[model samples]
Target chain A: MDMATMNKLMECATFANCYPRDVVFRQGDPATHFYSVLSGYVRLFRQNSEGREADIRVCGPGDSFADELIFGGDTYEYHAQAADKAMLARYDINRVRNAAQADDGMLARAIAGSLAGQLQETMDCIANDRLNTAVQRVALYLLEQAEGQESPASFRLAFQKSLLAGKLGLAPEALSRAFATLKGLGVHVHGRIIEIEDMDALRAL
Target chain B: MDMATMNKLMECATFANCYPRDVVFRQGDPATHFYSVLSGYVRLFRQNSEGREADIRVCGPGDSFADELIFGGDTYEYHAQAADKAMLARYDINRVRNAAQADDGMLARAIAGSLAGQLQETMDCIANDRLNTAVQRVALYLLEQAEGQESPASFRLAFQKSLLAGKLGLAPEALSRAFATLKGLGVHVHGRIIEIEDMDALRAL
Candidate 1:
C-alpha cells in the first residue's frame, strides 16, 4: 500500500482501447490474463441452458476481472464484455507471479483484495436472490448502485435494463413490475437513470 | 511444495477432534480461520427462510474450507458442519498473513494454490449446474466421487442421499430419478456405494 509499490503496479499495466460492446473474454475461453478497467463499464455474465445470458456481475472504472487465472487456471467460466467505450489495462499472468515474488505487500493485497471482492459480490448476489422479494431486490440494488456511483440520491445505470434484470436474476417482466413497485414507493426512474427520493427508505426496503 | 514447508504449515495449524453432526461454524460466525480436513467429511450449507438447508459443498479428507475471509470479509456466508466423525486442522489467518510477509514462495504458492483450488471447485459447481443435464449432474458427480475415492466401481456414500441431492441442487425425488437413470446406464448402487460400469457413457451424458 506504499507509494512506490502502488506506482509500480500502475506502471506494470498499460492502457488499451476497446470499442463499445467488444467482447473481452467469453465463457469457456482460456483465462490467460487479469484485467483492470481504467475507464468504462464491463459486464461479466454467463449463458443459461435456455440460451439466455445471465449477467453475473459488472465492473466499472477501477475494478478488476479474470482473477480465477491469477494463480493458474485454463478456462474462463464467465463472459466479460465492454459495456461502453473503454480503457482497460491488462497484466500478464507471469508479471503478476513475478510481482508476488518480489515481496510486495501491496501487490499481494491487490490480488487478495480482487478475489475477495468478487467472492463477496457473488455471495451477495446469491443471498439477495434467496433472502429478498423482487421489490427488495430492486430497492437494495438501487441503493448499491447509488453507493457505487458515490451519489446517494441520483445515478445512472451502466448497463441495459435487460442486463440489470439478468444481474438481479429476475425476469424482464418481473423487473418491470419491480420498477412499478419502486414507483409506488416514491422512487423515480427515467430510462437508465434512477433518482432515489430517500436512500434510507430504499435501504430499509 | 517441499516437505519442510508442508511441515511448517502443518505445525502452524492446530488440530481438533469432532463428533458427527457437530457444528464447525455457523453461517454468521466471524471467519478468523480456515480449516483443512485431516479426516472424515465436512458439509457446508446455507439455510433458507423455510428452514430448508441447501448444501453448497462437501469436503472430505485433504480438503479445505473457509478461504472467503482472506479477501477482507467479516463473517462466513455459509455453515460448515461435520458430516461424520472428523479430525480437522485449523490455521490462524494472522499466522498465514505473517508468513506471506516473509516473502516465502512456498507459502505464497500454498496460499495461491489453496485459493485457486477453491475457485476451481466453485467454477466446476457453476458449470455442472449450468452445462450438465439433470442426469449428467448425477453422473458427473458420481464420477468425481469415484475419482476422489479411488473406487469408481464401488464406494460408500459418506452421507445421506438427501444431503447429496442438496449439494447437486436437485430435489430428493430428482436425485432418486437420477440414480435410477444411472442404474439404467449400468451404474450399480446399493445403499450409498455406487458402481459405474461405463465411465465413457457417464461422461458422454
Candidate 2:
C-alpha cells in the first residue's frame, strides 16, 4: 500500500470502522460516504423488485466501494455489506471532491487514478457478459482470473459458482452445465479449485 | 480544457493526426500510444482472423481509449478508426506513467478521474446489457442519449444503427428486429433520430 495514499485518504475522509458481516450501507439509503477497504471483503448488491438479492461486485483490500455518489450524484443504486472478517475506512465524498478541486494535483490524481482502474475493469466485465454461450463466458471468466498467474493449469475460484454466475450474467444452472462441460473435457473441479488435466484439450475445447 | 493537462499531454507523446475513416491503429498492431479524443469521434473495433470488423466502442469528445496496454501489457485487442472529423491526442504510456510517478497532483488526478468515469459507465453498460432484453436495451440506450436533453422523449442516435448494433452486442438482423419492436411500442425510429411518442408506455414496456 502507498503510505501517501493512506495519509491522503485519512486526511480526506472519516473512517467509520466496520466489522465483518456488517452492513455498510443498505440499498435505497442515501450514498454519503465513499469507502476504502482497509482489510477484508466488501460486497455490493441490489435486490430486484421481487426482493431477490443480486451481488454486484466483491471488493477486496486496496479497493474502494460506494463511489457512485462520489460524482455528486443523488441516491444509491445498490447496498454494500461486508462479506467476511473485514475493516473499512470511510470518507465523505463531498470533502474528498472539494479537497481535490482546491489543490488540483496529487489528491486529485489519486482519486482519478482509482476511478479509472475501476472503469476499465467494469467495461471488460460488460464485454464478457455479452458473450452468448455459458461455456464461453465461463472460459473467459477463468481466463481473466488466471491472467498473470504463474501456473494457469490450476487456480482457485475467487467466489462461489452462484455469485460468479451472476457476474457472468448466466443462471446458476447454466454455470453448472458449463462446469460439467469442462469436466467432460477432462478439467477437474473440486469445490473452489479448478485443475485443467489437459491444458491443450481444454484450450482447444 | 486545462492548460496543465495540455502541457502534460504535449510532454508525453507525439501523434500523427488523421482524417475521418482513416485507421489510427489496427487490431493486431503493437499497442502504442494511448489516445485521447480531443474532438469528434473514434471507433475501436476488433478484426477476426478472417478480417471481419467488430466495433468495441465509439469514443467521442473528451473520451480516452486504448488503455488496456498501459498496465505493463502488450498487444492491441482492438483497432481504432476515426468516426468523424476527429482530433486525437496521443500519449506515450511510459512517459505518462513516469511523469505521474513523480508528480502528486492535477495531472495524475485528471488521468485517474477520466479512468474512473469510464470504468463506472462501462460497468453500468455491461450490467444493463446482461440484464435487459433487446427492446429494453434499446429503450435504455435512447434514454442515455436523451440524458442531457431538454426533453427526454426524443433524441438523435449518435452513431449509425450498424455501429450501434456492434456496441450493443447484437446482430444487424436482431437490431432491426429490435427497432421494429420499438416501433410497435410507439417509439419512432427514422434514420438516426429516435422519438418516444409515449414516455410512460416506453418505460412500462
Candidate 3:
C-alpha cells in the first residue's frame, strides 16, 4: 500500500486491546470490522461440531486479519481469538468500503493484493496436503516458517505445538513422528526455537 | 454490476470457441486474460508431479472462470480445460487493469466482488474438508448442486464421475459407495441426472 492510502486508513482506525485468549469474533458473526495486529498473536481457526478446533493461520505483530472479506462477505467466515495479550488497530468495514468506492480503485487494488496473498497461501496449503507425505509436510512447514516472505535463517515458533499440528493438519503423535523423521535430515527443534542444520537435505524432502 | 459497467467491459471483450477437451490455461501460465462462459462446461484442476489430478470446481454457461485473479495474480493459479464444446468472452488483462484504474473504484470493487466470491468458496471448501465425513461431503455436494444459489429440485452432473470423485477428494470406489449409501436414503443417480427423492431425509444427514 502507498503511504497516502495507509495514512488515510490509519487516520480513521482506532486502537483496541485484548487479553490473552479473548475471542475477537466467531464463525458466522456479522463482519463489522477488520484489524491489524500491533502486538502479540491472533489466531484464525475453524471448529467442528464436536468442538475440535483446527488452526488456519496465526497473525503476529505488523500483520492483518479478516481484511480480504471487506468487499463481498457479509459475516466472519471463521473464528479469531487472541493467542496472547494484544494491541490492534480496528478499521470500520463501512468506512473502508466507502473509501474504496470514493477512490480511483488504488485502495481497492491494494486490498485485492492482500486477498490474493491469502488466497495463494490457502491454495498452497491445500496442494501441500494433497501432494506431500506427513514428514514432507512437516519439513515444508519448518522451512516456510524459518524462511518466511522476508527470509530469516532461524525462527521461533510463535504458538503452541498443538496449534502447529492443527495448522499442519496432523495429529499430535503424527507431528511428533514427522519431527522425528526430520532429525535424520539435520532439522533441530529445541523447545520453541527451530533451526535447520542442513537446508539442502530438508529441501530435498 | 451496473448496466453501464457491464456495457463497458463487453465493449472491449472478444469471443472465442473451443471444442470438447481443450486446455484453456495450465496452472502457472501467465494469467493474460479472464473469461466469461457463453456455453458449455470448464473444469479447474491441480495436478501433482506423479500425473495425478484433483479438481477444484467446474464452470458452465453464464458462469465465469479465472476472473478473480485479474487484479493481483501473475499466473493462472490452476488449470482450466473445457469439459465440452464451449463459447467464451475473453477480456484482456491489461485492458481490464487500465479500465479499473480509470474508474471511480467501481470496476475494481466489482472485480473485488468476484474475488470475494471465490475466496468465500475456497474457505467453505476448507471448512467442509475439516468438518465433514466422506458420506456427508457427498451428500452435501449433492444438496449444494441441487440447491445452488439459484435453487432447483434436480440438477445434472456436468462432468465425468471420475472428475466428480477428484473434486470431492474421494476414491472412485468411495464415491460409488457414497452413491449406494445415498440410495438407501432415497437419493438417486441415474446416468448424469440426479434427483433427491427425499430432501428432508437427505438434509437430516
Candidate 4:
C-alpha cells in the first residue's frame, strides 16, 4: 500500500473506548468494521453452536482485530471483546477498502494475507477444541492463563468465568463442576483468582 | 458492485475441474484462492485433533467457498473437498481483490454479500461436528428425529444406543451419559421407546 492509500484509509478512522469485558463484535456478526488497538487489550475468539467460545488471541496496543473480514466474510467468523479498558481506532471495512481501491495490487495482497490469517485462527480453534472435553479444555485454559504470571502458580482470570464457560464450550454449571474437579485435583479458585496448589495435579487433570 | 468492477473481477478468474472426493484444499492451507462452483458439489469441513472430519456445509452449483478468509486470517479456516465431479472458477484472493481495488465499495459489498452467505449454511454442522458435546448431540439428534418423524412425540430408537451413538459420533459410554442427561431434561427413554414430553423444551436445547 502506498503512503497516499494508507493515509486515505487512516482518515476514515474513528476512535472509541471499550471497557473491559465489553463485546466488540461477535462471531457471525456482519464484518462491516475492524479495529486497531491504540491502548489496552482485545480478546478474539470463536463460539460454537453450544455457545462454547475458544480464545483465538489477545490483541494489545498496535494490534488489530476483525480487519480480515474485508477479504473473507460479510460476518465475522470470530468474536472480539475488550479484555481491558481499551481505546481503539475503528475502521469501516468498505471505507478502508475503498481508500485502497485505487491500487489493485495493494487490495489483492491485503485480501490474501488477511484471509489466510483468519483461516488459520479458525482451523486452530477447531483442531484444538473439537477433540477435547470440557474438563480438558478448561484445564488447558487455566494453564494458559497461569503462564507468564509473576507467580507462575497463580493468576487472575482475565474475564469472568461466565465468559470463560462460554468460550470453553461448557455450561455455567459445567464450568463450576470443572472448577470443582480441578479443585479436587489441587487447583484453587476463589472468585477470579486461581491458584495452582499442585501444578502437576492440575496438569494431570 | 458495478458491472465494470464485476467484469474486471471476472477477468481475473481461471477455471479448473476437481474430481469427486479430491482434496481441493485442506484446512490450514494458505488462503491464496477461493472457488465458485460451476457444476456438481463441494464439501467444506473442519477436522478435530483426533482426525475426525466434521462437515460445515457443501457447496453446490453457483455456490462459492473459501472466499471469506479474505477479511479474517492467514490460512483457510476449513477444508474443502469436491463432493462430486465439479468444475469451478478459482479466484486468487489477491488478484480478485486487486481487480476491485479501483472501487472499494464494490470490493467491500461483494465481500460482505458473498461471505455472509457462506457462513449461514452448515454452521451448525460445524458446531455439532467440531465442538458440541455428547449431550448436545443427543439433544440435536432428538430434534432432528422429531423433524423427520411423522409423530415426533413418540418414536422408536432408530437402532440401539450403541449404533445411534456411533452415528451421532459419540462413543457407547458417552451416548449413555448423553441419554442420562436427556432423561433429566424430561425426555423419556425406556430402551428406545423415546418420548419427548415437552417439544419446546427440547427445541430450547
Candidate 5:
C-alpha cells in the first residue's frame, strides 16, 4: 500500500489488545473489519463437523488477516484467535472499501495483489499436502520458514509442533517421526528453536 | 459483472479454438491474458517435478480462468488444457487493467469479487483434501456437482473418473472403493453418469 492509502486506513483504524488464546472472531461471525497484527501471533483455523480442526494460516507482526472477507463474503469462514498477547489495528470494511474506490483505485490494485499472493500460497500448500510424504512435507515447511534467512540459520517456530502438524495435515506422531528423520538432513530441533545446518540438503528433500 | 462491463470486456476479447488435449498455456508462461470459456471444457492442472499431474480445476462455459494471475505475478502457476474441443474468449491484461482503472473502479470491484471467490473455493478444496477421508471426499464432491438439481438427481460427470479422482486428491483405486461405498448411500454410478436416488441420505454420509 502507498503512504497515502496507509494514512487514510490508519485514520479509520481502531486499536484493540488481545490476551493469549482470546478469540478474535469466530467462523460465521460478521466480517465487519480487517485486522493487522502489530505484535505477537494469531492463528486462523477451520473445524469440521466431526470436530477435527485444520490450521489454515498463522499471522505475525505486520501481517493482515481476513482481508478476503472484505470482498466476496458477508461472514468469516474460519475462526481466528490470538496465539499470544497481541496489539492489533482494525479498519472498518466500508472505510477501506471507500478508500480503495478513491484515488483511481491504487489501493484496490494493492488489495488484488494481496489476494493473488494469498491464492498462490494456498495453492502451493494444497499441492504440497497432496504430493509430498509426511517427512518431505515437514522438510518443505522448514525450508519455507527458513526463507530469507542466511545459511546455517536458526529461528524459533511461530506455533507449537501440534499446530504445525495440523497445518501440514500430519498426525502428531508422524510429525515427531518427521522431525527425527530430519536429523539426517542436518536440522536440529531444540524445543521451539530450529537450527538449519545444511539448507541445500534440506531443500533437496 | 454488469452488462456494460461485459460489453467492455467483450469488445476487448479475441476468440480462440482448441482441440481436445491441446494446451492453452503452460505453467510459468507469461500471464498476458484472461480467458473465458465460450464453450466446452478446460482443465487447469499442475505438474510436479516428479512428472505427476494434479488437476486443480475445470472450467466450463462462461467460467473464467487465470484471474488470480491478474495481480501479484506475471506468470501462470498452472497449465491450462482443453478437456474437450473448446472455444474461448481471451482479453488482454493491459486493456483489462486500463478498463478497471476507468469508470470509478466498478470493474475493479468485480475483479476483486472474482478473486475472492476463487480464493474461497481453493481454500475449501485444501480443507477438503486435508480433513476429509477418500470416501467422504467423493460423497461431498457428488453433492457439490448435484447442487441445484432435483432430489432424485442424475447428471453426467464433467470429466472421466480418473480425472475426478485426481481432482479429489485420491488414487484411482481409492476412488473406486469410495464409489463402491457410496452405493450403500443410494448412489448409482454408470460409466460417466451418476444418479443420486436419495439426496438427504447421501448428504447424511
Candidate 6:
C-alpha cells in the first residue's frame, strides 16, 4: 500500500486494546470491521462440536485478520483471540470499501493481494496436510520458521507446542516424535527454543 | 454485478474454447487473467509427486476460478482442466482491476465477495477433512448436493464417481462403502443418479 492509502486507512481506523487471551471475536459474530494487529499476536481458529479446536493462522504485527469477511456475508465463520496484550486498528468495512472504490485501483489491488496471499497460504496448508508425512511436515515447518535467516540460525516457537501441533494437524505426541526424528538433521529442540545446526540437511528432508 | 458493470466486464473479456480433458492452465503458469466458465465444466486440482491427484473444486457455468492469483504473485498455484467441452471467458486482470477501482465500491465489493466465498469454502474443506469421519463427510456431501431441493428429491452427480470421492477425501472403495451405508437412510444411488428418499433422515446424519 502507498503512503496515501495507508494514511487514509489509518485516518478512518479506530483503536482497541486487548489483554492477553482476550477473545476478539467468536464464530458467528457480526463482522462490521476488519482488524490489523498494531502490536502483539492474534490466533484465528475454529472448534468442532466435540470442542476440539483447530488453529487456523496466527497474525503478528502489521498482519490483518478477517478481512475476507469484508467481501462475504456479515458474520464471522471462525474465532479470534488475542495471543498477547495487544493493540489493534479496526477499519470500518464500509469506509474501507468506499475508499477502495474511490481509488485508482491501488486499494483494490492491495485488498486482492492480501486475499490472494491468504488463499495461497491456506491451499499450501491443505496440500502439506494431505501430501507430507508428520516428520516431513515438522521439518518443513522448522525451515519455514528459519526462513530469511543465515544457516545454523535459531528461533523461538511463536506459539505453544500443542497449538503448533494443532496447526500441523498432528497429535501432540506425534509432534514430539517428529521433533525427535528431526534431531537427525541437527534440529535441537529445548522447550520453546529451537536451533538448526544443519539447515541444509533439514531442507533436504 | 449490475448491467453496466457486466457489460464493461464482457467488453474486456476474450473467449476460449476447450475440448473435453483439455488443460486450461497448469500449476506454475503465469496468471495473466482470471477465467469464468461460460459453458460446461472445469476441474481445479493438485497432484503430488507420486502422481496422486486431489480434486479441489469443480466449476460449472457462471462460476469463476483463478481469482486468488489476481491479488498475489503472477503464477498459478494449481492445475485447471476442462471436465467437459467448455467455453470460458478470460478477463484481463489489469483492466478488471482498474474498472473495479473506478466503480462505486460495487465492483470492488463483488471481487471481495468472490474471494471471501472461495476462502470460506476452502476453510470449510479443511475443517471437514480434519473433523469429520469418512461416512460423515460423504453424508454431509450428499446433503450439500441436495441443498436447495425439496425433500425426497433426486439429482445427478455433477462429475464422475471417482472425482466425487476425491472431493470428499475418500478412497474409491471407501466412497462405495459410504454409499452402501447411506442406503439405510433411504439414499438410493444408481450409478451417477442419486435419489434422496428421506432428506430428513440424511440430514439427521
Q: Which is better, 2 or 3, measured by DockQ? A: 3
Collision pairs in model 3: none
Per-model TM against the reference: 0.81, 0.81, 0.88, 0.56, 0.92, 0.89
- For model 2, residues A1-205, the per-residue Cα lDDT tens digits are 2676557667866665566668888877876788888777787766655566655677888898766456555566777887767777888887777766666366655565566567556655554455336887777667566665543378988666766777677788989999998887766789999876655554443
lDDT for model 5 comes to: 0.83
How much does each candidate deviate from the true structure in C-alpha RMSD? 4.1, 3.9, 3.2, 8.1, 2.3, 2.6
Best by TM-score: 5
True contacts kept of each: 0.18, 0.46, 0.41, 0.07, 0.52, 0.39
lDDT scores in order: 0.74, 0.70, 0.78, 0.68, 0.83, 0.82
For residues B1-205, what per-residue lDDT tens digits would candidate 2 score against the true structure? 3787668768986655668789888766887689888787788766644565655578987788875455444566677888777888888887876766665455665565566566656655655565567887777777667665543378787777877887777779988998898887777888998887767666665
Cα displacement (Å) at residue A29, model 6: 1.8
- Find the candidate with the highest DockQ and give its number: 5
Please provide, for model 6 over A19-76, each residue's C-alpha lDDT reduced to its tens digit, 9 standing for 90 to 100: 9889999988988888999898888888876687777777889788888876657888
Runs of candidate 1 exceeding 4 Å displacement: A27-30, A46-55, A104-106, A126-136, A146-155, A171-174, A177-189, A195-205, B47-53, B103-105, B130-136, B146-158, B180-188, B195-205
Q: Per-residue lDDT tens digits of candidate 6, residues B28-93? A: 888888999999889887877677677777788878888776555687878899988899999888
CAPRI class of candidate 2: acceptable
lDDT by residue (tens digit), candidate 5, B88-111? 999888788777767656677777
Docking class of 1: acceptable
lDDT of 1 at B124: 51
Q: Write the per-residue lDDT of candidate 4 for residues A1-205, one digit (tens) a residue.
A: 4676566667878999999889988787777888989998887666765676655556778666666555445878777888779999999988766654555445444544444444444444444454567787788888887776443388888667766775565678999988887777777887899988666665665
Span of ten consecutive residues with least summed lDDT in model 5 chain B: B100-109
TM-score result, candidate 3: 0.88
- Stronger candidate by TM-score (3 vs 5): 5
Tell me which of candidates 4 and 5 scores higher on lDDT.
Answer: 5
- Per-candidate DockQ values are 0.30, 0.35, 0.53, 0.12, 0.62, 0.49
lDDT winner among the candidates? 5
